[model samples]
Target: MMTFIESVQQALQYDFILKALLVGSLIAVSASVLGLFLVLKKYSMIGDGLAHVSFATVAIALWMSASPLLVSIPIVILASFFILKLSEKASMHGDAAISLVSSFSIAMAVLIASMARGFNVDLMSYLFGSILVISNFDVVISAVLSLVVIVTVIFFYHDLFAVTYDEEYAQAVGMNTKFYNYLLAVLTSITIALGIRIVGTMLISSLIVFPTVTALQVSRGFRTTILIATLISVICVILGVLFSFAYNLPTGAVIVLMNAIAFGLAFLAKLLRR
Candidate 1:
Protein backbone atom coordinates (compact mmCIF):
# COMPACT_ATOMS: atom_id res chain seq x y z
CA MET A 1 0.00 0.00 0.00
CA MET A 2 1.18 3.50 -0.72
CA THR A 3 2.05 5.56 2.33
CA PHE A 4 -0.01 8.70 3.01
CA ILE A 5 2.85 11.03 2.10
CA GLU A 6 3.52 9.10 -1.09
CA SER A 7 -0.17 9.19 -2.00
CA VAL A 8 -0.33 12.96 -1.50
CA GLN A 9 2.70 13.49 -3.68
CA GLN A 10 1.34 11.18 -6.36
CA ALA A 11 -2.04 12.96 -6.47
CA LEU A 12 -0.40 16.37 -6.74
CA GLN A 13 1.47 15.29 -9.88
CA TYR A 14 -1.70 15.35 -12.00
CA ASP A 15 -3.01 18.71 -13.19
CA PHE A 16 -6.56 17.38 -12.93
CA ILE A 17 -6.08 16.58 -9.27
CA LEU A 18 -4.53 19.98 -8.67
CA LYS A 19 -7.47 21.73 -10.27
CA ALA A 20 -9.97 19.68 -8.33
CA LEU A 21 -8.26 20.50 -5.05
CA LEU A 22 -8.08 24.21 -5.78
CA VAL A 23 -11.65 24.57 -6.98
CA GLY A 24 -13.18 22.23 -4.43
CA SER A 25 -11.44 23.90 -1.48
CA LEU A 26 -12.57 27.35 -2.56
CA ILE A 27 -16.17 26.19 -3.10
CA ALA A 28 -16.15 24.36 0.22
CA VAL A 29 -15.18 27.45 2.17
CA SER A 30 -17.79 29.71 0.61
CA ALA A 31 -20.50 27.08 0.87
CA SER A 32 -19.81 26.47 4.55
CA VAL A 33 -19.89 30.16 5.43
CA LEU A 34 -23.08 30.88 3.50
CA GLY A 35 -24.58 27.69 4.84
CA LEU A 36 -24.22 29.01 8.40
CA PHE A 37 -26.50 31.90 7.59
CA LEU A 38 -28.94 29.79 5.57
CA VAL A 39 -29.26 27.14 8.25
CA LEU A 40 -29.73 29.78 10.91
CA LYS A 41 -32.37 31.53 8.81
CA LYS A 42 -34.14 28.23 8.11
CA TYR A 43 -33.62 28.48 4.33
CA SER A 44 -31.38 25.48 3.86
CA MET A 45 -33.46 23.85 1.12
CA ILE A 46 -32.67 26.73 -1.23
CA GLY A 47 -29.33 25.12 -1.91
CA ASP A 48 -30.93 21.86 -2.98
CA GLY A 49 -33.55 23.66 -5.03
CA LEU A 50 -30.91 25.70 -6.78
CA ALA A 51 -28.92 22.55 -7.41
CA HIS A 52 -31.79 21.14 -9.40
CA VAL A 53 -32.10 24.41 -11.25
CA SER A 54 -28.42 24.21 -12.09
CA PHE A 55 -28.97 20.75 -13.54
CA ALA A 56 -31.61 22.13 -15.87
CA THR A 57 -29.42 25.06 -16.81
CA VAL A 58 -26.53 22.71 -17.45
CA ALA A 59 -28.74 20.72 -19.75
CA ILE A 60 -29.79 23.87 -21.54
CA ALA A 61 -26.21 25.02 -21.84
CA LEU A 62 -25.03 21.68 -23.16
CA TRP A 63 -27.85 21.54 -25.68
CA MET A 64 -26.80 24.94 -26.97
CA SER A 65 -23.11 24.01 -26.95
CA ALA A 66 -22.48 26.72 -24.39
CA SER A 67 -20.55 26.57 -21.14
CA PRO A 68 -22.53 25.26 -18.17
CA LEU A 69 -21.04 27.70 -15.70
CA LEU A 70 -21.63 30.66 -17.96
CA VAL A 71 -25.29 29.83 -18.54
CA SER A 72 -26.15 28.42 -15.12
CA ILE A 73 -24.85 31.35 -13.12
CA PRO A 74 -27.26 34.00 -14.34
CA ILE A 75 -30.25 31.68 -14.68
CA VAL A 76 -29.82 30.23 -11.21
CA ILE A 77 -29.45 33.71 -9.77
CA LEU A 78 -32.73 34.69 -11.38
CA ALA A 79 -34.40 31.53 -10.12
CA SER A 80 -33.28 32.40 -6.63
CA PHE A 81 -35.05 35.76 -6.81
CA PHE A 82 -38.11 34.13 -8.35
CA ILE A 83 -38.28 31.85 -5.33
CA LEU A 84 -38.20 34.89 -3.12
CA LYS A 85 -40.97 36.48 -5.15
CA LEU A 86 -43.12 33.40 -4.82
CA SER A 87 -42.85 33.50 -1.08
CA GLU A 88 -43.45 37.22 -0.80
CA LYS A 89 -46.07 37.77 -3.49
CA ALA A 90 -47.80 34.46 -3.96
CA SER A 91 -47.76 33.74 -0.26
CA MET A 92 -46.38 30.32 -1.07
CA HIS A 93 -44.25 28.94 1.71
CA GLY A 94 -40.49 28.77 1.21
CA ASP A 95 -40.35 25.00 0.86
CA ALA A 96 -43.31 25.07 -1.47
CA ALA A 97 -41.60 27.59 -3.69
CA ILE A 98 -38.45 25.49 -3.62
CA SER A 99 -40.38 22.39 -4.56
CA LEU A 100 -42.06 24.15 -7.47
CA VAL A 101 -38.79 25.43 -8.88
CA SER A 102 -36.90 22.21 -8.23
CA SER A 103 -39.49 19.97 -9.82
CA PHE A 104 -39.86 22.23 -12.82
CA SER A 105 -36.12 22.35 -13.37
CA ILE A 106 -35.76 18.61 -13.20
CA ALA A 107 -38.55 18.14 -15.68
CA MET A 108 -36.95 20.64 -18.03
CA ALA A 109 -33.61 18.92 -17.76
CA VAL A 110 -35.08 15.54 -18.56
CA LEU A 111 -36.94 16.91 -21.55
CA ILE A 112 -33.89 18.71 -22.85
CA ALA A 113 -31.74 15.63 -22.46
CA SER A 114 -34.26 13.59 -24.34
CA MET A 115 -34.53 16.17 -27.10
CA ALA A 116 -30.78 16.58 -27.60
CA ARG A 117 -30.17 12.84 -27.61
CA GLY A 118 -26.85 13.39 -25.81
CA PHE A 119 -24.32 15.76 -24.29
CA ASN A 120 -20.55 15.86 -24.82
CA VAL A 121 -20.05 14.54 -21.31
CA ASP A 122 -21.98 11.88 -19.49
CA LEU A 123 -25.09 13.08 -17.71
CA MET A 124 -24.15 10.93 -14.77
CA SER A 125 -20.94 12.92 -14.42
CA TYR A 126 -22.87 16.15 -13.89
CA LEU A 127 -25.48 14.50 -11.68
CA PHE A 128 -22.95 12.76 -9.48
CA GLY A 129 -19.72 14.78 -10.12
CA SER A 130 -16.44 13.95 -11.83
CA ILE A 131 -14.14 16.79 -11.03
CA LEU A 132 -11.33 15.30 -13.08
CA VAL A 133 -13.20 16.21 -16.25
CA ILE A 134 -13.40 19.87 -15.28
CA SER A 135 -11.47 22.02 -17.75
CA ASN A 136 -8.78 24.60 -16.92
CA PHE A 137 -11.21 27.42 -17.68
CA ASP A 138 -13.68 26.11 -15.09
CA VAL A 139 -11.01 26.16 -12.42
CA VAL A 140 -10.19 29.81 -13.04
CA ILE A 141 -13.82 30.92 -13.17
CA SER A 142 -14.83 28.88 -10.14
CA ALA A 143 -11.89 30.19 -8.12
CA VAL A 144 -12.82 33.82 -8.86
CA LEU A 145 -16.50 33.31 -8.03
CA SER A 146 -15.69 31.38 -4.85
CA LEU A 147 -13.50 34.22 -3.65
CA VAL A 148 -16.25 36.70 -4.47
CA VAL A 149 -18.69 34.78 -2.30
CA ILE A 150 -16.23 34.60 0.59
CA VAL A 151 -15.17 38.25 0.50
CA THR A 152 -18.74 39.51 0.19
CA VAL A 153 -19.73 37.52 3.27
CA ILE A 154 -16.79 38.86 5.24
CA PHE A 155 -17.47 42.44 4.22
CA PHE A 156 -21.13 42.25 5.15
CA TYR A 157 -20.56 40.00 8.14
CA HIS A 158 -22.28 42.08 10.77
CA ASP A 159 -25.22 43.09 8.60
CA LEU A 160 -25.77 39.50 7.51
CA PHE A 161 -25.64 38.27 11.09
CA ALA A 162 -28.10 40.88 12.21
CA VAL A 163 -30.47 40.04 9.37
CA THR A 164 -30.11 36.31 9.90
CA TYR A 165 -30.62 36.24 13.66
CA ASP A 166 -33.36 38.79 13.94
CA GLU A 167 -34.88 40.10 10.77
CA GLU A 168 -37.46 42.23 12.52
CA TYR A 169 -34.88 43.75 14.82
CA ALA A 170 -32.55 44.33 11.89
CA GLN A 171 -35.28 46.18 10.06
CA ALA A 172 -36.18 48.23 13.12
CA VAL A 173 -32.52 49.12 13.60
CA GLY A 174 -32.41 50.75 10.12
CA MET A 175 -30.81 47.89 8.23
CA ASN A 176 -32.13 47.07 4.76
CA THR A 177 -33.40 43.67 5.69
CA LYS A 178 -34.94 43.13 2.27
CA PHE A 179 -31.70 43.80 0.45
CA TYR A 180 -29.77 41.53 2.80
CA ASN A 181 -32.35 38.75 2.37
CA TYR A 182 -32.08 39.01 -1.41
CA LEU A 183 -28.33 39.20 -1.08
CA LEU A 184 -28.33 35.99 0.90
CA ALA A 185 -30.48 34.30 -1.73
CA VAL A 186 -28.27 35.48 -4.60
CA LEU A 187 -25.14 34.27 -2.81
CA THR A 188 -26.74 30.88 -2.21
CA SER A 189 -27.64 30.69 -5.89
CA ILE A 190 -24.06 31.33 -6.99
CA THR A 191 -22.67 28.85 -4.48
CA ILE A 192 -25.07 26.14 -5.58
CA ALA A 193 -24.26 26.74 -9.24
CA LEU A 194 -20.55 26.37 -8.54
CA GLY A 195 -21.06 23.47 -6.14
CA ILE A 196 -22.74 21.30 -8.79
CA ARG A 197 -19.26 20.79 -10.22
CA ILE A 198 -17.79 19.92 -6.82
CA VAL A 199 -20.31 17.37 -5.54
CA GLY A 200 -22.66 17.04 -8.51
CA THR A 201 -26.26 18.13 -8.76
CA MET A 202 -27.45 15.43 -6.40
CA LEU A 203 -24.94 15.93 -3.60
CA ILE A 204 -23.98 19.58 -4.01
CA SER A 205 -26.54 20.72 -1.47
CA SER A 206 -24.96 18.51 1.15
CA LEU A 207 -21.83 20.62 0.90
CA ILE A 208 -23.98 23.54 1.92
CA VAL A 209 -25.74 21.67 4.71
CA PHE A 210 -23.51 19.06 6.34
CA PRO A 211 -20.62 21.08 7.69
CA THR A 212 -22.62 23.78 9.40
CA VAL A 213 -24.98 21.30 10.98
CA THR A 214 -22.05 19.22 12.19
CA ALA A 215 -20.33 22.28 13.58
CA LEU A 216 -23.51 23.21 15.41
CA GLN A 217 -23.42 19.92 17.25
CA VAL A 218 -19.94 20.65 18.59
CA SER A 219 -19.73 24.42 18.89
CA ARG A 220 -21.62 27.50 20.07
CA GLY A 221 -21.47 31.19 19.28
CA PHE A 222 -21.76 32.45 15.70
CA ARG A 223 -18.08 33.12 15.05
CA THR A 224 -16.91 29.87 16.66
CA THR A 225 -19.44 27.84 14.70
CA ILE A 226 -18.42 29.50 11.44
CA LEU A 227 -14.77 28.78 12.18
CA ILE A 228 -15.36 25.10 12.92
CA ALA A 229 -17.62 24.64 9.90
CA THR A 230 -15.07 26.21 7.53
CA LEU A 231 -12.37 23.89 8.84
CA ILE A 232 -14.55 20.82 8.47
CA SER A 233 -15.65 21.78 4.97
CA VAL A 234 -12.13 22.40 3.64
CA ILE A 235 -10.68 19.26 5.27
CA CYS A 236 -13.45 17.03 3.98
CA VAL A 237 -13.27 18.31 0.39
CA ILE A 238 -9.49 17.89 0.27
CA LEU A 239 -9.50 14.43 1.83
CA GLY A 240 -12.52 13.27 -0.09
CA VAL A 241 -11.00 14.22 -3.44
CA LEU A 242 -7.66 12.64 -2.55
CA PHE A 243 -9.24 9.48 -1.17
CA SER A 244 -11.44 9.01 -4.22
CA PHE A 245 -8.44 9.48 -6.48
CA ALA A 246 -6.43 6.92 -4.56
CA TYR A 247 -9.23 4.39 -4.39
CA ASN A 248 -10.83 4.99 -7.82
CA LEU A 249 -14.16 5.64 -6.17
CA PRO A 250 -16.80 8.16 -7.21
CA THR A 251 -15.54 11.61 -6.22
CA GLY A 252 -18.84 13.20 -5.24
CA ALA A 253 -19.98 10.17 -3.28
CA VAL A 254 -16.73 10.07 -1.38
CA ILE A 255 -16.89 13.76 -0.51
CA VAL A 256 -20.47 13.45 0.74
CA LEU A 257 -19.59 10.34 2.74
CA MET A 258 -16.78 12.21 4.42
CA ASN A 259 -19.29 14.88 5.39
CA ALA A 260 -21.72 12.26 6.69
CA ILE A 261 -19.03 10.71 8.81
CA ALA A 262 -18.09 14.08 10.24
CA PHE A 263 -21.70 14.78 11.08
CA GLY A 264 -21.95 11.43 12.79
CA LEU A 265 -18.88 12.15 14.91
CA ALA A 266 -20.24 15.53 15.92
CA PHE A 267 -23.61 14.06 16.79
CA LEU A 268 -21.91 11.41 18.90
CA ALA A 269 -19.91 14.08 20.70
CA LYS A 270 -23.06 16.00 21.47
CA LEU A 271 -24.71 12.94 22.92
CA LEU A 272 -21.68 12.20 25.04
CA ARG A 273 -21.60 15.73 26.32
CA ARG A 274 -25.23 15.58 27.32
Candidate 2:
Protein backbone atom coordinates (compact mmCIF):
# COMPACT_ATOMS: atom_id res chain seq x y z
CA MET A 1 0.00 0.00 0.00
CA MET A 2 1.17 3.49 -0.72
CA THR A 3 1.79 5.81 2.19
CA PHE A 4 -0.55 8.70 2.90
CA ILE A 5 1.88 11.15 1.34
CA GLU A 6 2.04 9.06 -1.79
CA SER A 7 -1.72 8.99 -2.04
CA VAL A 8 -1.91 12.73 -1.57
CA GLN A 9 0.68 13.27 -4.25
CA GLN A 10 -1.13 10.97 -6.66
CA ALA A 11 -4.36 12.88 -6.09
CA LEU A 12 -2.60 16.18 -6.68
CA GLN A 13 -0.60 15.11 -9.72
CA TYR A 14 -3.30 13.66 -11.99
CA ASP A 15 -5.91 16.13 -13.23
CA PHE A 16 -8.60 13.49 -13.81
CA ILE A 17 -7.96 11.81 -10.46
CA LEU A 18 -7.98 15.19 -8.76
CA LYS A 19 -11.36 16.03 -10.22
CA ALA A 20 -12.75 12.66 -9.22
CA LEU A 21 -11.50 13.08 -5.67
CA LEU A 22 -13.00 16.54 -5.40
CA VAL A 23 -16.36 15.59 -6.91
CA GLY A 24 -16.55 12.32 -5.04
CA SER A 25 -15.85 14.08 -1.75
CA LEU A 26 -18.55 16.64 -2.47
CA ILE A 27 -21.10 13.94 -3.22
CA ALA A 28 -20.00 11.90 -0.22
CA VAL A 29 -20.50 14.80 2.15
CA SER A 30 -23.91 15.59 0.68
CA ALA A 31 -25.04 11.99 0.89
CA SER A 32 -23.87 11.58 4.48
CA VAL A 33 -25.73 14.61 5.77
CA LEU A 34 -28.98 13.87 3.98
CA GLY A 35 -28.60 10.18 4.60
CA LEU A 36 -28.85 10.70 8.34
CA PHE A 37 -32.40 11.92 7.99
CA LEU A 38 -33.13 9.20 5.44
CA VAL A 39 -31.89 6.51 7.82
CA LEU A 40 -33.97 7.92 10.64
CA LYS A 41 -37.02 8.05 8.42
CA LYS A 42 -36.31 4.49 7.23
CA TYR A 43 -36.28 5.61 3.60
CA SER A 44 -32.67 4.98 2.74
CA MET A 45 -33.61 2.69 -0.15
CA ILE A 46 -35.14 5.66 -1.88
CA GLY A 47 -31.69 6.66 -2.98
CA ASP A 48 -31.06 3.28 -4.55
CA GLY A 49 -34.33 3.34 -6.39
CA LEU A 50 -33.82 6.87 -7.56
CA ALA A 51 -30.42 5.94 -8.88
CA HIS A 52 -32.02 3.26 -11.00
CA VAL A 53 -34.54 5.71 -12.32
CA SER A 54 -31.76 8.11 -13.12
CA PHE A 55 -30.07 5.33 -15.02
CA ALA A 56 -33.17 4.95 -17.12
CA THR A 57 -33.24 8.67 -17.73
CA VAL A 58 -29.63 8.62 -18.80
CA ALA A 59 -30.27 5.82 -21.23
CA ILE A 60 -33.19 7.67 -22.69
CA ALA A 61 -31.10 10.79 -22.96
CA LEU A 62 -28.45 8.86 -24.84
CA TRP A 63 -31.08 7.62 -27.22
CA MET A 64 -32.45 11.11 -27.79
CA SER A 65 -29.09 12.87 -28.01
CA ALA A 66 -29.85 15.22 -25.11
CA SER A 67 -27.97 16.20 -22.01
CA PRO A 68 -28.32 13.42 -19.47
CA LEU A 69 -28.46 15.82 -16.57
CA LEU A 70 -31.16 17.86 -18.21
CA VAL A 71 -33.22 14.79 -18.96
CA SER A 72 -32.69 13.21 -15.53
CA ILE A 73 -33.49 16.07 -13.19
CA PRO A 74 -37.13 16.46 -14.17
CA ILE A 75 -37.73 12.74 -14.21
CA VAL A 76 -36.31 12.28 -10.74
CA ILE A 77 -38.30 15.22 -9.40
CA LEU A 78 -41.48 13.91 -10.93
CA ALA A 79 -40.86 10.38 -9.73
CA SER A 80 -40.26 11.57 -6.19
CA PHE A 81 -43.45 13.59 -6.24
CA PHE A 82 -45.45 10.69 -7.59
CA ILE A 83 -43.98 8.28 -5.07
CA LEU A 84 -44.82 10.57 -2.19
CA LYS A 85 -48.33 11.05 -3.50
CA LEU A 86 -48.82 7.38 -4.13
CA SER A 87 -47.57 6.50 -0.68
CA GLU A 88 -50.15 8.76 0.90
CA LYS A 89 -52.95 7.67 -1.37
CA ALA A 90 -52.46 3.90 -1.53
CA SER A 91 -51.37 3.24 2.04
CA MET A 92 -48.77 0.87 0.66
CA HIS A 93 -45.39 0.12 2.10
CA GLY A 94 -43.07 2.86 0.85
CA ASP A 95 -40.33 0.33 0.20
CA ALA A 96 -42.61 -1.69 -2.01
CA ALA A 97 -43.46 1.32 -4.13
CA ILE A 98 -39.81 2.25 -4.45
CA SER A 99 -38.91 -1.30 -5.39
CA LEU A 100 -41.58 -1.38 -8.04
CA VAL A 101 -40.27 1.83 -9.52
CA SER A 102 -36.74 0.55 -9.36
CA SER A 103 -37.57 -2.67 -11.15
CA PHE A 104 -39.55 -0.98 -13.88
CA SER A 105 -36.93 1.67 -14.43
CA ILE A 106 -34.12 -0.85 -14.67
CA ALA A 107 -36.01 -2.87 -17.23
CA MET A 108 -36.69 0.21 -19.30
CA ALA A 109 -33.08 1.26 -19.16
CA VAL A 110 -31.91 -2.17 -20.27
CA LEU A 111 -34.17 -2.04 -23.28
CA ILE A 112 -33.11 1.46 -24.24
CA ALA A 113 -29.46 0.75 -23.73
CA SER A 114 -29.69 -2.36 -25.85
CA MET A 115 -31.02 -0.30 -28.75
CA ALA A 116 -28.22 2.26 -28.39
CA ARG A 117 -25.25 0.39 -29.83
CA GLY A 118 -21.65 1.37 -29.14
CA PHE A 119 -22.48 2.05 -25.47
CA ASN A 120 -20.59 -0.65 -23.62
CA VAL A 121 -18.10 1.62 -21.93
CA ASP A 122 -20.62 4.32 -21.17
CA LEU A 123 -23.03 1.80 -19.70
CA MET A 124 -20.29 0.27 -17.63
CA SER A 125 -19.36 3.66 -16.32
CA TYR A 126 -22.94 4.31 -15.26
CA LEU A 127 -23.13 0.91 -13.68
CA PHE A 128 -19.81 1.02 -11.82
CA GLY A 129 -18.76 4.71 -12.15
CA SER A 130 -15.60 6.01 -13.81
CA ILE A 131 -13.76 8.28 -11.43
CA LEU A 132 -10.64 8.41 -13.61
CA VAL A 133 -12.74 9.76 -16.48
CA ILE A 134 -14.53 12.47 -14.56
CA SER A 135 -14.79 15.73 -16.50
CA ASN A 136 -14.81 19.35 -15.40
CA PHE A 137 -18.57 19.45 -15.90
CA ASP A 138 -19.04 16.55 -13.53
CA VAL A 139 -17.08 18.35 -10.81
CA VAL A 140 -19.03 21.56 -11.31
CA ILE A 141 -22.37 19.79 -11.19
CA SER A 142 -21.47 17.86 -8.05
CA ALA A 143 -20.30 21.02 -6.31
CA VAL A 144 -23.48 22.91 -7.17
CA LEU A 145 -25.77 20.09 -6.09
CA SER A 146 -23.80 19.61 -2.86
CA LEU A 147 -24.18 23.26 -2.03
CA VAL A 148 -27.91 23.19 -2.70
CA VAL A 149 -28.40 20.10 -0.55
CA ILE A 150 -26.35 21.49 2.32
CA VAL A 151 -28.11 24.82 2.30
CA THR A 152 -31.54 23.24 2.14
CA VAL A 153 -30.75 20.84 4.96
CA ILE A 154 -29.45 23.61 7.18
CA PHE A 155 -32.31 25.92 6.37
CA PHE A 156 -34.90 23.39 7.45
CA TYR A 157 -32.98 21.54 10.09
CA HIS A 158 -35.54 22.10 12.83
CA ASP A 159 -38.46 21.02 10.76
CA LEU A 160 -36.56 17.97 9.62
CA PHE A 161 -35.60 17.11 13.18
CA ALA A 162 -39.12 17.47 14.51
CA VAL A 163 -40.56 15.40 11.72
CA THR A 164 -38.00 12.63 11.98
CA TYR A 165 -38.11 12.39 15.77
CA ASP A 166 -41.88 12.62 16.14
CA GLU A 167 -44.14 13.24 13.21
CA GLU A 168 -47.38 13.25 15.16
CA TYR A 169 -45.98 15.70 17.68
CA ALA A 170 -44.61 17.85 14.91
CA GLN A 171 -47.99 17.95 13.23
CA ALA A 172 -49.64 18.81 16.54
CA VAL A 173 -47.24 21.71 16.92
CA GLY A 174 -48.12 23.08 13.47
CA MET A 175 -44.98 21.90 11.73
CA ASN A 176 -45.49 21.09 8.06
CA THR A 177 -44.28 17.60 8.58
CA LYS A 178 -45.84 16.33 5.40
CA PHE A 179 -44.31 19.09 3.34
CA TYR A 180 -40.83 18.50 4.67
CA ASN A 181 -41.20 14.77 4.24
CA TYR A 182 -42.10 15.12 0.59
CA LEU A 183 -39.48 17.80 0.15
CA LEU A 184 -36.89 15.45 1.53
CA ALA A 185 -37.97 12.78 -0.89
CA VAL A 186 -37.57 15.20 -3.77
CA LEU A 187 -34.21 16.37 -2.56
CA THR A 188 -33.06 12.79 -2.09
CA SER A 189 -34.04 11.98 -5.65
CA ILE A 190 -32.01 14.93 -6.82
CA THR A 191 -29.11 13.79 -4.68
CA ILE A 192 -29.25 10.33 -6.19
CA ALA A 193 -29.28 11.79 -9.70
CA LEU A 194 -26.29 13.98 -8.99
CA GLY A 195 -24.48 11.08 -7.36
CA ILE A 196 -25.14 8.50 -10.08
CA ARG A 197 -22.26 9.78 -12.21
CA ILE A 198 -19.95 9.99 -9.25
CA VAL A 199 -20.64 6.65 -7.57
CA GLY A 200 -22.66 4.79 -10.21
CA THR A 201 -26.05 3.14 -9.81
CA MET A 202 -24.69 -0.11 -8.40
CA LEU A 203 -22.83 1.51 -5.47
CA ILE A 204 -24.54 4.85 -5.06
CA SER A 205 -26.66 3.66 -2.18
CA SER A 206 -23.55 2.79 -0.20
CA LEU A 207 -22.64 6.44 0.05
CA ILE A 208 -26.17 7.13 1.24
CA VAL A 209 -26.35 4.39 3.86
CA PHE A 210 -22.94 3.44 5.18
CA PRO A 211 -21.73 6.70 6.66
CA THR A 212 -25.02 7.31 8.45
CA VAL A 213 -25.09 3.74 9.71
CA THR A 214 -21.57 3.98 11.11
CA ALA A 215 -22.27 7.33 12.73
CA LEU A 216 -25.39 6.03 14.44
CA GLN A 217 -23.37 3.38 16.21
CA VAL A 218 -21.85 6.05 18.45
CA SER A 219 -23.80 9.25 18.04
CA ARG A 220 -27.07 9.74 19.83
CA GLY A 221 -27.54 13.43 19.08
CA PHE A 222 -28.56 14.76 15.67
CA ARG A 223 -25.69 17.19 15.26
CA THR A 224 -23.16 14.63 16.38
CA THR A 225 -24.62 12.07 14.03
CA ILE A 226 -24.43 14.34 10.99
CA LEU A 227 -20.92 15.49 11.81
CA ILE A 228 -19.64 11.96 12.35
CA ALA A 229 -21.30 10.78 9.18
CA THR A 230 -19.67 13.56 7.18
CA LEU A 231 -16.26 12.73 8.62
CA ILE A 232 -16.73 9.05 7.90
CA SER A 233 -17.80 9.81 4.35
CA VAL A 234 -14.83 12.07 3.67
CA ILE A 235 -12.40 9.54 5.07
CA CYS A 236 -14.00 6.79 3.02
CA VAL A 237 -13.79 8.87 -0.14
CA ILE A 238 -10.12 9.65 0.35
CA LEU A 239 -9.16 6.12 1.30
CA GLY A 240 -11.30 4.57 -1.42
CA VAL A 241 -9.81 6.76 -4.13
CA LEU A 242 -6.33 5.97 -2.95
CA PHE A 243 -6.95 2.23 -2.81
CA SER A 244 -8.55 2.24 -6.24
CA PHE A 245 -5.59 4.08 -7.69
CA ALA A 246 -3.06 1.75 -6.15
CA TYR A 247 -4.86 -1.45 -7.10
CA ASN A 248 -6.53 -0.35 -10.36
CA LEU A 249 -10.02 -1.10 -9.08
CA PRO A 250 -13.35 0.48 -9.70
CA THR A 251 -13.46 3.73 -7.78
CA GLY A 252 -17.15 3.65 -6.86
CA ALA A 253 -17.06 0.10 -5.57
CA VAL A 254 -13.88 0.76 -3.64
CA ILE A 255 -15.41 3.79 -2.01
CA VAL A 256 -18.45 1.78 -1.03
CA LEU A 257 -16.34 -1.10 0.23
CA MET A 258 -14.32 1.31 2.32
CA ASN A 259 -17.56 2.52 3.83
CA ALA A 260 -18.60 -1.04 4.63
CA ILE A 261 -15.23 -1.74 6.24
CA ALA A 262 -15.52 1.44 8.25
CA PHE A 263 -18.92 0.40 9.51
CA GLY A 264 -17.61 -3.02 10.44
CA LEU A 265 -14.75 -1.47 12.37
CA ALA A 266 -17.05 0.92 14.11
CA PHE A 267 -19.35 -1.92 15.07
CA LEU A 268 -16.44 -3.86 16.46
CA ALA A 269 -15.32 -0.87 18.48
CA LYS A 270 -18.82 -0.38 19.89
CA LEU A 271 -19.02 -4.02 20.90
CA LEU A 272 -15.67 -3.81 22.58
CA ARG A 273 -16.66 -0.65 24.41
CA ARG A 274 -19.72 -2.37 25.71
- Highest TM-score among the candidates is held by which one? 1
1-274: candidate 1 lDDT, tens digit per residue: 5576688789999999999999999999999999899998889999999999999999999888899999999999999999999999998999999999999999999999988876836666789988877998999999999999999999999999999999999999899898999999888988888888888999998998999999999988999999899999999999999999888889899999999999999999899999
**Tens digits of per-residue lDDT for model 2 on 117-209?**
766567768888777776777678778978898889999998898898888999998888889998898778777887887678888888999
Give per-model TM-scores: 0.97, 0.95
- Cα-based lDDT for every prediction: 0.92, 0.85
Name the regions of candidate 2 deviating beyond 4 angstroms. 1-8
Question: Any idea how many clashes model 2 has?
Answer: 0
- Off by more than 4 A, model 1: 1-5
Backbone atom clashes (below 3 Å) for every candidate: 0, 0
